[model samples]
Target: MIGSTSWVIPGTYYENALLLEGLVDFVELLVYTWDEDTKTLLFNEMDKLLQLDLSYTVHLPMDRLDNVIRAYNFFEEARFPVINYVLHPIKGWRRTLGEKVALENLKELIEPHNRMVFDVGHHFLGKKFPAHLKEAIVEIHAMGVIDGRDHLPLDRETAAFIKGFMGDLITENVLINFEVFDLEDLKNSLKVWSDTFVE
Candidate 1:
């Protein structure tokens, strides 16, 4: 099943509860940066949410490298089968550090997870795409664009990219997500995906 990250509400737990109520077969959790104090609060909140028994996939925080590292370790230790981990190429450091460094770091961070959600927008903005990173996971979800921007809707170019990427990966059932904002975009994206993939 396809789902979108719930970041519309103020608190994570509250938004999560709302998402559960929506009854989507799957949901994406964007667990952003958390300090020690915040982490404690978050854990307590998560415990309450877990009581609901709603299954979900987590999107690791991308604010800082340390945050990503810590989140990865937490999920690993908890043995949580993370559905996908989102990666953002370090801004200014991209040119200097290179995509290889980011790829290595991402591999180390998500070794425990079996899947990944690749944000085509970020990769496009960074102008650094690591083809090798595709080999590290069993499932790859290409996040599509919205309007003229990436990570929103399935535009022509992004659709082509998905087709090409899927061909190169040769992985069965590679998930593609259109990060749409409105109902129109969502409907259009579904049509675009159907037209492109369905016979």
Candidate 2:
């Protein structure tokens, strides 16, 4: 399934997600630091989301693994069925929180078959998507980030390569989130995906 990042929806996080009811299969909630006030707001909105019965996945903050664990627990206790907890293999965090280690750590919080969200662009940053992790991938953050500039539109050659490499995995159940910030870029990226990989 194809989805857009919640950041480009131009509203409160919950409001933006609500707007995606019929437009996409799921919403990857881009979560940041959960300050006390923000945490309250999030709990309230999460209740609304549960009531609405929208399919969702959470994109945890890249800066903190504790936040990721906490978010997962909150959603689990709330009885929300999150598809995946997407993660980034941040620099300097490799020793303590590598992708595999994080997945293992998450196993203590969740089931053995818990899924993960993978970012394709992160592969270029020395964060390789290992063969072992492929079985647990339920969603993907798709974008083109070159020379440290992220959220840039996917270029033609890169788009073609993606179609060649990732097109086969475009099943109806797996979510491909266009994790770009600009609205136009998101739309264009969707079109590129549709034209190139959705056949």
Best by lDDT: 2
lDDT of 1 by residue, 73-98 (tens): 67667655455555544433232221
Which candidate tops TM-score? 2
Worst 10 residues of 2 by lDDT: 104-113
Per-residue alpha-carbon lDDT of model 2 for 126-194, expressed as tens digits? 445555656566666677767866567766655776555554665766667777876678777877777
Instruction: For model 2, state the Cα shift of residue 34 in Å.
Output: 2.5
- Provide the lDDT at 106 for model 2: 28
Structural RMSD, model 2: 5.9
Q: Can you list the residue pairs that collide in candidate 1?
A: 145-152, 145-153, 146-152, 146-153
Positional deviation of residue 20's Cα in model 1 after best superposition, in angstroms: 7.1
TM-score of 2: 0.73
Error of 1 at 17 (Å): 6.6
